[model samples]
Target chain A: MELFEEQGFEKTSAVQIAQRARVTTRTFFRYFPDKEEVLLADADADAVKETLVQHLLQKPDVTDTLQAVTRTLADFDWEKLGPRQILRQRDAMIASDPRLLERELIKQQQLTDALRDVLCRRGTAPDIAELAANTGSQVFRTAYRKWLEDNNDGDLTTITENVMSLLAAIMARGPVPATAARLP
Target chain B: MELFEEQGFEKTSAVQIAQRARVTTRTFFRYFPDKEEVLLADADADAVKETLVQHLLQKPDVTDTLQAVTRTLADFDWEKLGPRQILRQRDAMIASDPRLLERELIKQQQLTDALRDVLCRRGTAPDIAELAANTGSQVFRTAYRKWLEDNNDGDLTTITENVMSLLAAIMARGPVPATAARLP
Candidate 1:
């Protein structure tokens, strides 16, 4: 991460990273399949997903799957992942490189799919489950970004609730009366 | 796409694809930087994004940005992209390959960012723009998947409307009354 931040992700090599860490290239490869994974690696992503899914599954009432999904995520101890500054740098690094960005997105999509499946298993309608899972992820993403950007460690739950309310507000405004006529 | 479907994406080579197309590898590279692009390429995605942004800009009312974003997408002549079966097959192919799936997601995120930027340019609050763009995109994605699966080529507009209403319903249901107690 230090090398990537200093010289850019594309220019940095796995061998160089290995050298910096005083390890064999083979050992580095064992830990990360590629240089992109070096920064994006979350050995615990699957575990985190499972923990969140289990949390959602245990909810006494998941009739409101959007709220259920959002709370499941927003309520997690994100600080346990790392300090806010480190996570922010990692995010910026991913954002700066399209390859890393794509990998990050696939990881996100996988998490969303897992949440949707959990919702389906909990008896939510498939369509509603899909919308709730995807929308909730988006809401949390916005809140997470805001939390990272805050100089003071922001309360993620409050940020998440505010983001959710923003979504609700936009949907509540409803469509313009004339837009229907504009459809082809 | 035919080659990929027949032999799988990873198993196929650019040389083989070029051979099948009766073109030199040079010619193939001239058109697509890689085999992944062969199936995932949207030569017109940028143009489409620009067109959608322009439509949103021209909206008589931009206050309802979510509706504006979704309607712009739902109203487009998606049929012009290709037949339903071809599009479905392409979608399936992308889904089966993590590499292609990641690329597709990046493309989707880029479109969402473009829409969000347009909304911001139109004076919507930044947070609201992010939520509306991302949420609206999610709604349309579910609707689109449904549209592709329908044998009769279901109406995109109606499907998009239904999906949007599902989101509205979930949000309107409000959070589960007791979930707050569960939050740490």
Candidate 2:
């Protein structure tokens, strides 16, 4: 991270990262394929998929897919990922470049697909699984953004709950039409 | 459209497209700088941005940003875009190529940014506006997928409304915890 902050993500090499950690270049390769992997590829998508599906499967009696989906998101232990300040800095670094952002988006799309497939394997209907996966990913993304604040010490679980709660609150309040521009 | 459908988006040449259309290459350049623009550039982002902003501006009394955002989306006239079969074909063409999908996602991101800017201009808090824009875009994406079915004759406006309503309904039901896999 220090090297990335100093020389930018593009300029930094995986060997330099490994050297700093007093490890062999081969060791670094074993863990992450490249320097980009160090920052953005830390999250194990397969583990996340398993965790989410397991949560949904545990509650077979709960027929509402969306509810189970959001709960699965809210139940994840986000603090284990890393410190909030470090994560925020990482996010800022990724956001600085369009290519990096595109890569991140592609990763997100893959995660959505993984979740969708897991839901299908668990016997959820295809259409419902698709919706659940997309919506669940959005909920996690929204909460993760909320979780990245400097003063905000909220963990992933609480933040996820809060986001879902906000969705519910806004839905009940409904759309306000008066503020929209009316043509003369 | 016929040329692209027959030869694929990448394989077809602009000269061939122009010749097939009974127009000179010069005329084709005048209308669209390239052939890919023929498929990917139909939905003018500027026009969509203006429409969305105007809708939000007209109703100064509507304080709910999400409501205004979704309503602005629902206000788009879908039928004017052309017949369902043609639109479906276009979507399929785009879906077949990863580059086309990336372009589409980038366009969606731009729309989200446009909405966020419009909401901030309307006195909504910056954070709230950002959230509203992201959420609103998701609503549109989900509804648009549903609207693309071959036998589904549902208009975009109704589909958008139905998606938003479903969100409200799901939120009312709350999350179901038992179906989730046990942490143990």
Runs off by more than 4 Å, candidate 2 = A1-62, A79-82, A120-127, A150-152, A175-184, B1-43, B79-82, B150-152, B175-184
Put down candidate 2 lDDT per residue, B64-164, tens digits, no spaces: 76677777877776555556665665566556545455556666777788888888887876756766778777777777777877364666776676667
CA lDDT of A86 in candidate 2?
55
Please provide, for model 1 over A1-184, each residue's C-alpha lDDT reduced to its tens digit, 9 standing for 90 to 100: 5578779888999998777656689866765567776665556677788889899989998997888999999999987866787677667756866756876898899999999999999998887888889999998999899899988777998888878776766776785232221111
Residue range B73-162, candidate 1, lDDT tens digits: 899877666667766766775686676687689989999999899899989988888888998998899889989888875799998887
DockQ of each: 0.34, 0.14
Candidate 2 chain B has its poorest 10 consecutive residues by lDDT at B175-184
Structure candidate 1, residue pairs in collision: none
Across all models, the iRMS values in order are: 7.0, 9.4
What docking grade does candidate 2 earn? Answer: incorrect
DockQ of candidate 1 is 0.34
TM-score, prediction 1: 0.78
